[model samples]
Target: MHLQFITAACLLASASAHSTFQQLWINGVDAGSSCARKPASNSPVTSISSPDLACNAGAAASAGVCQVKPGDDVTVEMHQQPGDRACRNEAIGGNHYGPVLVYMAAVSDAKSAVGSNADWFKVAHMGLVSNNPDYFGSRVLNDNCGHFTFKVPAGLAPGNYLIRAEVIALHVASGSGGAQFYPACFQVNVGGTGTVKPPTVKIPGVYKASDPGILINIYQDLTTYVLPGPTAYGQASPVPATTAWPTTATWNTALQPSTVPTVVPAAGATGIGKA
Candidate 1:
């Protein structure tokens, strides 16, 4: 029985490492209604070309889409569940660290928008550090560090849009097709008077197997990590100020990640073992 228990423990730890996009909040409201993977999904979208890349394509339209003013602080939180009610950061193993990116595209209508053909515009991106050369060190995916806040441009036009959040893990990126892509999409309806149109790109076509960010190693000593994709439209000097920042905003700190204790799962032990 002892031997059997040990094996089970190792397997459970491995199981928890499955990268999944469990929850996403828009302007502080739970927006799972517009996402393809509901709160109950068991796994994340692993394929770059899966229909999910486009609003997870076929799930019926959701009522959770948000109606927001241009200056709103669109805070987004991505979490990974190791088990039911046991939530943690999106990144688990040291191998799963890279850049976190968000994009937006105006849709004809929020209620009828499915993002497959929508031309996406780069809006927000976070992957830079003055301390870490790799830009994305273990700090990105460790210790419940999966939350991000997107500031809606005050100059944005009023309309329906789809927002895409992505995190690329470069641990195995040394080889072709080795990088793992985890992306989640949100539908929103913005209400404002500003009118600054942003450039757009087609999905699946935008990301290549050989993209610089997608095929690199995070462990190597580096100085700078160039974020892939066209610079977000209208991302010029004096970016729009964040209006009414959330009291619970999770800023991507440039400081080194502080250490935190973790429960080490015993090798081959069952039931997650004793801490």
Candidate 2:
């Protein structure tokens, strides 16, 4: 009886740390689940090569496509569960430390883009920012109430695109397959006149099981961390973070809306919110 109780407690504790990107903030406006292709559950995709590694397992297709222009300050929001955006609790509880990466893929249709084969390009990545008493990007995300913002490339061509937001939790990454990946997708139509197409790579093929970033020991005294995936849109290389990443909360929790933004379907669009 005692062993069973301990195992149950352990399982509950482990489950508390799992999270998913469920909301989006465009130019500081709460877009909510408008164009979000939220996963079926707030769970981790363990297999690196699994097709689920792209958007997430069992994520339904989204019919709503958020309209946005280039150079918008887009923020991806995460929490332990859907529609639970309390600032009192950590967005992702437990010490599920790792990196926060965002990738973008251009497609013919944002609403129907299958993430498995689409060409994805890294736009923003935040890995280990400090080592002396190590601080990770996941920690920064928690500090900001689960909001990580990045800008849409000003030179990106106007078209349909999928924004893939991911958080890798390395708490149990001492072994080969112990890492946890939580990725979510958002569909958007970029409506600018710019016409620059960045380099791209497929999702499942971007992350290798043997890659040092995917398979690493964060507990050890580490000086550098190699970020996974291809080079960012305009960067020369994936530079390893060396400076001390800030831990203070940037997103105003006091002003956070208790409810998600109401998504009004566009003209001729039948339905909206979580297909």
Across 112-211, the per-residue lDDT of candidate 1 in tens digits comes to 7666678888776755433233335223434334556667777888888877777776656667776666676666778778897777888766777777
Report the C-alpha lDDT of model 2 over 156-231, residue by residue, as the tens digit.
Answer: 8999999999998877666788788999999988887999898899888888777788788776788878778876
Against the reference, the lDDT scores of all candidates come to 0.55, 0.82
Worst 10 residues of 2 by lDDT: 266-275
Best by lDDT: 2
TM-score of candidate 1 versus the correct structure, residues matched by position: 0.69
The runs of at least 3 residues in candidate 2 whose Cα sits more than 4 Å from the true structure, single-residue gaps closed, are 1-13, 236-244, 264-275
Q: Which stretches of candidate 1 lie over 4 Å from their true place?
A: 1-16, 26-50, 56-60, 82-94, 130-138, 141-145, 236-275
Candidates in order, TM-scores: namely 0.69, 0.88
**Count of backbone collisions within predicted model 2:** 0
Q: Give lDDT: candidate 2, residue 273.
A: 16
lDDT of 2 at 275: 5
Instruction: List CA RMSD, all candidates.
Output: 12.1, 5.4
CA shift of 161, model 1, Å: 0.9
